[model samples]
Target: MSDSNTTDFTNPSTFILLGIPGLEAAHAWLSIPYSIVYAMAILGNFTILFIVKMEPSLHEPMYYFLCMLAATDLVLSTCILPKMLAIFWFRSREINFDACLIQMYFTHCFSAMETGILVAMALDRYVAICHPLRYSTILTNPVVAKIGLVVVLRGIILFFPYPFMARWRPYCSTNIIAHTYCEHMAVVKLACSDTRLSNYYGLFVILFVASVDLAFIAVTYTQILRTIFRLPTKDARLKTFGTCGSHLCVISCSYIPSLFSFLAHRFGQNVPLYFHILIATVYLLLPPMLNPIIYGVRTKQIWETLLRLFPPKGG
Candidate 1:
């Protein structure tokens, strides 16, 4: 471990990440599970992108949004997993200051992007279910492209201040980060100066993004459910609801852990440090690993495409 007393306290060249406080001895064992999750996330999301690209029938709005989701998952997981595994497996815990900022930006930016994509997906379902005759016209290829652009731009613009915020602060305190990655709060907390502005800004971003995006998603799904129930046949209703099953599962996976981590960091004073770190780390990884599996199993088209691409033998 680098000695804080000897190093320049104002601006250390590199910040030392502790991986997970209170679990240093178990780092090697913990790396195994995290590595597995990262591998699965990589494979699953890439497969989703590949299948959606190669299959002509999946070139519609829903699948296109799915591709966006997969890509976002890829960015979100990749932003942290490799560095985290390095910290755990090889004891490579030193991260350059600018690099840390970069990681923090991508981590939060893609998280916001994921939320926006989920909203777009909910809207897609709404149009498809409530107005089947006008679904195609409502979500045209151009509109979908525009929506994708907006999601990407929204994240980029919203998070562009994160790096600057962290960079402007003078880190005269210790250079050790208790978390695996350079999280926004963790980095800003190291600053010697007042961090109330940074802290409140972080809270504002979280509330603004989560509240607006989740509210839109809630309203969209409410309309969708109302439409589904209006159908006369039980079979029609069941099938219509079935299409949203995978999305609902994905939404739960994405938001629940995320909300818990966010709230716990702010309010869970009694929670152990390692527990908070573990939840935050898993929050970054678990959804990417689960999302592809959920869609593959629950969506008929994706499942059939997967089987066709890699069929079982001994027929």
Candidate 2:
């Protein structure tokens, strides 16, 4: 981490997060909203995890990825929200710089893994919907396990450069990060040395990696749709797309905000700074909150499993 991303606190160990400026002054009021969002995000993702784990009938590649997705979201939101809420609730923005960097690294890593996991889910859908006969052979437990390992490694490998890049520079003495969490680019920008190289690298990775992943998913689904069209019943078509509903929701939630945020950063001068920061943060939080609900409730087996897990008592 650079001094640019640090504050000259009395302790030297901790720095205040420059939370949304206006709201920081009203901690008691802001805490109410932040706490609510943090709670909802946690509970929602946990419920999805519960259903996926308990529902034996959902023990397929599709739901397995859904489980991974929900689990990732649960952790992702937890990692950032507690600190954010503390900042908002107590007017306590103090976070250790090492702690901030670690938080940023894991957050980036898990986020990358989530994208990869979603890609796997898309491939699973394509196989199940487009090639039913060979689905088992192609997406077996061993294969899925291998893919899981790849996703985790991919996450770590992809974002590992940021910390190293930060280390390579002579950091500046600025403290206030424009956003809530120490985002990689924001942190990289904090360095006193030339960040043009790092900036280009970050953009290349985001565009190349995120774009390639999205494009691959798009092509797989396009093929799946073509296959679904040949099915005898209209219900079969909806069923196939339905299997992808959760993934669709995730992709939309994740990618669109990124597109908009990037465009706003580049093009719009009048746009409020908090708009960018808040939207970016929300995009991260929403998928974890919504993934389980979108994927779990829509799944018949998971819905049934959830019911079984929480049955009516006085029937």
Candidate 3:
């Protein structure tokens, strides 16, 4: 066995994550809200998955995409929040180097998968609304499963290099990360070696994966809008738009904070560290917490199923 005392100059042994810098005194208080959000995310996503799985009527393409979304949300939040809560509740901020790398991998991989899933969901919407007659033929169960597999594989491929690249760079300086979770950019910035390659690749993944997904979503929605506009009656348009409301809300919830967080991290020279950190945390947690609520409120099927599951006492 290798000696624990022996040090490798290239790879860090451990990293100190300074959660919520300047608000160290408020970590305990912060944990309250953060813990609540984490609980909501877990419960909400689990409920979505359970409901979709248990209901035979919901075993369709749209709900299949939702199942993937719920799974992604569950994973994305789980990858980051537990450690964040540890930092807040127990002040356990020292993460082993290998563990940190693993956490970073999950964070990026799950996020990429989430983006891809959202794009897939948008495509599903486009097909159902624009080509209702061909929807079944286009997005069959096998096709949806294949799409899910591709999303997962694409995410893994994109993020696989991040940790390895960061690991090879020497972290000779004080290994302090100014965030609660292990993110690729945040961790790589601490390395002593030149990070041009890391930066380029990170930007590539962000642009290629997230930006591309967003672009596709926008295009799909545009086509959907054109189709909706051409509908014969106002009620048809309203009903169709209502069906899309939940997804639009979810898309906004996911992408807005994500874009803000990315911009702040990369280009917000005048922005405060706490702002970046807070946005990153929210960006990570908010979608998972809101997705189920949005779907439940806006989707008649899910709402009715939920009502049936929790019937009125008097009834």
Provide the overall lDDT of each model, using Cα atoms, as 2-decimal numbers. 0.92, 0.77, 0.90
Steric clashes per prediction: 0, 3, 0
lDDT of 1 by residue, 197-309 (tens): 89888889989999999999999998998998899999999999998999999999999998999889889999999999999988889999999999999999999998998
Can you write out model 3's per-residue Cα lDDT over 133-235, one digit (the tens) per residue? 9999999989999999999999999899988998888876667898999988889988878999999999988989876898899899999999999999999
The global Cα lDDT (0 to 1) of model 3 is: 0.90
For model 2, state the Cα shift of residue 58 in Å.
2.2
Q: Give the residue spans of candidate 3 off by over 4 A.
A: 1-9
Candidate 2 structure quality by residue, lDDT tens digits, 95-194: 7777877888888888888889989988998888888899999999999989888988888888888767765665546656666787888777666778
- After superposition, the stretches of candidate 1 with alpha carbons farther than 4 Å from their true spots are 5-8
Off by over 4 Å in 2: 1-13, 26-28
Top candidate when judged by lDDT against the true structure = 1
